[model samples]
Target: VNLLFSANRWEMASEIVDDLNRGIVVVCDRYAFSGVAYSAAKGLDFAWCQAHDRGLPLPDSVFFMRVEPQVGALRANFGDERYEDVDMQVRVRERFDDPRLRQGVPWH
Candidate 1:
């Protein structure tokens, strides 16, 4: 599944590059960082999770919206997905806060 996510990004590489070349800004809701963070939270090795996304175009800016786990759980449709549990979100948030994962990205 991680590979699939990376492949999905790779598949869009050409279009993304084209947009950049045309001076158009592109925004992605979830990029490679999310993949690594979520997978690492699920017990995958962090470095291994990051390996799959190596060489993908780096975003010019990254914004992380911090939300309390319980608060997030109260959001509408929060439980519709497999990883929506508050416990899982807490784990994922920890992973996202790791400085190693934020390296090289212009996080806001």
Candidate 2:
């Protein structure tokens, strides 16, 4: 699934580069880092998850909007997805907060 997710992004790589070259700002809701974070939370090796996304276009800026797991669970349709459980959300949050994962990225 992670490989498929990365491939999906790779399919858009050229278009993203084109837009950037033309001075158009591109925004994405989820990118490589999210893939790594989520999969890592599920017990995948962090480096292994990251390796699949290697060489993908790096975002100019990365923003992580921190929300408490319980608070997030309160949001509408929170349980609509497979990873929506509060416990899973907590694990995912910890993965995102991992310093090794954040290295070399300008995260806000």
Candidate 3:
């Protein structure tokens, strides 16, 4: 398991998972799921996002935190912090609700 904050697609995650064939777990902060959400927010096809993540090592346990864009924006607000596009965040959150994204990795 690889930890990636702000998950991307499975291409990189799969590479990392494939690199480790031993009985050790690599902890990751984020993974392919992030890409699904972010890309979905961008109005990209959720299936396409998932397709890009195919063949990645599946996490034994997966968790998702359902959040609203406004909530996220408030929480992410920090002085001197680089800003994010709130609209994009909303789109990403919507993508998380996509059936494709809901399929794999039972959420905790």
Best by TM-score: 2
Model 1, 1-108: lDDT tens per residue? Answer: 778988899999889989999999999999999998889999999999999888888899999899999999889999999999998999999999999888998898
Q: Candidate 3: misplaced stretches above 4 Å?
A: 1-21, 76-83
Worst 10 residues of 1 by lDDT: 52-61
lDDT of 2 by residue, 36-72 (tens): 9999999999999999888888988898899999999
CA lDDT, candidate 3, residue 50? 68
lDDT of 3 by residue, 1-108 (tens): 112322444346656666567555676676677766776676666676566566767777667777776776676452234326677776767676767776757877
lDDT of each: 0.91, 0.92, 0.63
Q: After superposition on all CA atoms, what RMSD does each candidate show versus the true structure?
A: 0.9, 0.8, 5.1
Order of quality (TM-score) = 2, 1, 3
How close is every model to the real structure, measured as TM-score? 0.95, 0.96, 0.68
Estimate the overall C-alpha local distance difference test score of candidate 3. Answer: 0.63
lDDT accuracy of residue 28 in candidate 1 = 94
